[model samples]
Target: MLKLDDANIEAICGQAAQLPSPSLPEVAVIGRSNVGKSSLLNAVLGKRGLLRVSQEPGRTREVIFIRVGTRGYVVDLPGYGFARVPLSVKHAWGRLVEAYLARRARGVMLLLLDIRREEPSPGDMQMVDWFRHYERRFSVVLTKADQIPRGRWKSASDGIARALGLDKDNPPFIVSVKSKEGIDSIRRLLTQGLMAE
Candidate 1:
């Protein structure tokens, strides 16, 4: 799998209706705010700051699209679990996200989770349920795996899968940007998903 060395970010779509007609297959990166979504993108692409890494949660208001390769597109969706932000702003973003998920063409979605924890909040579960309802192809990937002891990887992944109602046979991968774990697997998965007809 080729690492993202020169992935070029395309346009930032403010509204789902305004999304440019894309020819390539798209893979959406989604997770709670500060779940290392930006960092993970940078790591996968081997480019720092490709996606804006913001300390302030919910800084990414737009849905940014980038070309990963000849046939693949990477979509950085706005983080939805941010708190302490204005309710009006949150509501607007939420509506936009929902519309996109509901209307966009089918594609693969990588839902990120922090490796340190197993259980996610209600909002997280809602996202998973939404994907399931739409019959969308999705996978769970636990980021920051280096933070947890090596022995705990399986247990943590299993717990998360069970909590999310995912089958034990399809558990989330334990990945770490620093350790380079699961990078190859993720790239392969993305490549396959993009190539599938």
Candidate 2:
């Protein structure tokens, strides 16, 4: 029953200094390119055009700040790997992401991985390591859940957790934007702060 139609983006910034004062709690969506970050954001907002869906990977070049009903913020970051951009630009994305992850206070990171993927990518692993090292509160979300059969969801979630070195009890959230499964759970986690998963 959670509704995100009230979501609105307050600011968009690439540099840490340009970020807004962050008057509300924040949740960030991050992952490799083409991982459905945009789709998930659009679904959460209950609007399709809120986030531009691009076929090209690495299209989001800056950090986008989407404010939700005067309550909190949902930040969407640029994807990490295999963007058809110059080396300099790629490094810039890294710096922007690193700075945000390290400095954002009272923020929970939603680390997204495709449910269809069994093995965590190198970039995904590195991100998890960074989160652990910084003691940041984060949860993994396995997107594209509809790609796999419903009966296999548990096995897939467990496999992904093991691959990421997370305890079996700490499996990533399995969600499918198409089927509307697990969307409410994500909403609660975002607005309520780490509810029982």
Candidate 3:
């Protein structure tokens, strides 16, 4: 993957209500904690540690931004399903995500799923449905591609599509931070998605 220049970041909100205006096309990365979302972001940008990686889930707590050139911005949201975090915190995060999605006029969410885990959690489904309800343009991505066997990937991807209500026409891309698969396609799709509007 080609190196991406360091993105200029600005803190948008402590709570979602305080989020910055949707002045630029924004793409949000969402998933359960430890689903390789941070790793994927770093890998795609050819930078290490741009987004923090945590063994324990729910380490990220805020809606953060990384400017993607002059045309767009990449938003990293707090992860869901971190068992150790307080219920209050989880609820707050949920509200934050919901509000940000609702208010951001130019949001193009990228939902990340784990390939080894074939199905979405109830929370994941809620998020998907939320995006659908808001009529947001989005796509689902399966991360950690290299961990699964090559032959099994087809079945795993198929299962994910079925479970997520995605059709054959709109299948998820299997990606790996370790092997760098599907990074280019994501970059292209993101570029096109952001530039189109």
Candidate models: Cα lDDT each: 0.80, 0.81, 0.80
Give the per-residue lDDT of model 1 (tens digit) for 1-197: 54457599988888868777656678888888878777887877778868888778876788888887677678888888777888987787877777767765546888998988759777779889888887777889999999989999988888888899887576787788888999878777777766756
Error of 3 at 136 (Å): 1.0
Candidate numbers sorted by TM-score from highest down: 3, 1, 2
Q: Which regions of candidate 1 fall more than 4 Å away from where they truly are? A: none
RMSD of 2: 2.6
Q: TM-score for each prediction?
A: 0.91, 0.90, 0.93
Task: Name the candidate, 1 or 3, with the larger lDDT value.
Answer: 3
Model 2: pairs clashing at backbone N, Cα or C within 3 Å: none
Summed over model 3, clashes come to 0
Q: Which portions of model 2 miss their true places by more than 4 Å?
A: 1-3, 194-197
- The residue pairs found clashing in candidate 1 are 4-45
Q: Count the backbone clashes (under 3 Å) in each candidate.
A: 1, 0, 0
By summed lDDT, the worst window of 10 consecutive residues in model 2 runs over 188-197
User: In candidate 2, residue 119 scores what lDDT?
Assistant: 82
- Residues 1-197, candidate 3, lDDT per residue (tens digit)? 22245565667465976788788788788988888887887777667867788787876788888887777777888888877877888889889999888875685788899999868888789888998888877788999889988899899988878988876787898899888889888877667656756
Ranking by lDDT: 2, 3, 1
